[model samples]
Target: MAAKDLSTMYGLSESDPEQKLINRAGMSASDLEQIDRIMAEMGRMRQIERRIMRSSQEFMKLNETDMRALRKIISAKHAGRSVTPGELSQYLGISSASVTKMIDRLEAHGHVLRTKHPTDRRSQCVEVTEETHLAARDQVGRHHAKRFEAASRLSSEERDVVIKFLAGTSDAMESSLGSPLDDDAR
Candidate 1:
């Protein structure tokens, strides 16, 4: 089989000057080339993330929001806490009614259960079913564990630098939205 062309998948190579922004004052071609390579890696990571999301959604038979809800519930469970519909609504930035509908859908699919609140008799708690939890752990959870391993392999200084770079990138994206993201939204 012919070798696949990565340039087409990853956009123009660093050697293509037209693909890069105007070079900053005092920056050499070498600097620009490095920046282009970094941006290309970022694009590759984004594409991989999209593929992973599609595969996870398909395998789990759930939409993005459903998967996010499940993740929140799993987090809460790990923290030794129970989640309520109201909490889910707040976390998801959706209306209570919408959260109720989502819960209904999840419950019907046997992914979650509505259990009586251990502390509050007036409210109920949401729990991930054992089967669903195990499945998620076996799939997405395992993937994330690999990510943790990769991050752990980085030196503390390297991790700090990565953290700062990612934060700056996130801030730039939020700024491009024409308004700052709210603290709660973050």
Candidate 2:
């Protein structure tokens, strides 16, 4: 097919830069459909995330920021890493001072511990206590299991499709916006 014909098939205007690239690459309708599906799935995932956040707030009695910080710290410890306030600040897109205050509160609650960094003499590391770990595991595990149980009414194929669709959506979004969970700096 001619470049113009292929671009028209993909619904790209002739003057669009993407249209020029697509014409050079010869994209398919299935590719366009896949992109559209991914975009739609992303919207659905955001709605699900919001609902989960709301449910967590109602059941856990913790604000979203606190819950997120706790979850991040727990995940870091589960991965065998000591989390730093700076890292949490970057991950949460908050100031380091705010992260320090949050850590202090968590420490007071006996949910976290602050210790000297393994290698850095000047920095301290935050770790979840065993008690906190167990509590977090039980709490989050049960909540998620219940959520999945409710979802289990769907057939296996339908569940697989949902998982794949969400995974693809997440990947596309992560590609567009850098992953907030990645610990690039300690």
Candidate 3:
């Protein structure tokens, strides 16, 4: 499609609200190209991300719900906070009862611990056990090492550029979308 046609599809005509907004912001063709490049890079990155996630899930032998819960627990723990089942439910947008069930399974498997909440007598906080911590660290390290080994086949500068671009792209995306996994909602 022509650039004009493509832009129109996105509601970017001269008379459209989007064009007026772009004009007020003084966006140029290069800026638009940068946005386009970033979006294209995002698409490629998503494909790679999905493959990596699938491979990691397979390596960990985790199903969808288990993986989701584990990720929430690990991420929260990594941020130095014990997450309540209710908080996890809110974060995952699931029912609290479902989170409770998942937490039970995780606790039973020794991956997580449920303890009385410090401030709430009726609530419990979920904490990752040492086993979960060690397992995550080891698995991530192996996956990263493998990815690095593959990248090493590229010229040093190319590898560095790719890594830098991906990091920057990730940061930009996180800033734009508020979360890395937000796109997964679609």
Write candidate 2's Cα lDDT for 134-179 as tens digits. 7666766676787689679889998898888767756776777875
C-alpha local distance difference test of each model: 0.83, 0.71, 0.71
Can you tell me which runs of candidate 3 are displaced by over 4 Å? 1-41, 141-186
When summed lDDT is taken over every stretch of 10 residues in candidate 2, the lowest stretch is 1-10
Tens digits of per-residue lDDT for model 3, 1-186 = 234212323333433455554453677878766565555555565677788777767866766767767767777777877778887887777898898888888788788888888898998898888877778678655766877797988998988888898777668767888755642242
TM-score of 3: 0.54
Top candidate on lDDT is: 1
Model 2 reaches what TM-score against the true structure? 0.56
Better of 1 and 3 by TM-score: 1
CA displacement after TM-score superposition, residue 130 of candidate 1 (Å): 1.0
Can you rank all candidates by TM-score, best first?
1, 2, 3
* Ten-residue region with minimum lDDT total, candidate 3: 1-10
Predict model 2's lDDT versus the native.
Answer: 0.71
Residue 39's C-alpha lDDT in candidate 1?
A: 72
Please give the clash total of every predicted structure, in order.
Answer: 0, 0, 0
**Best TM-score goes to which candidate?**
1
**Greater-lDDT candidate between 1 and 2:** 1
Look at candidate 3 and tell me the lDDT of residue 101: 85
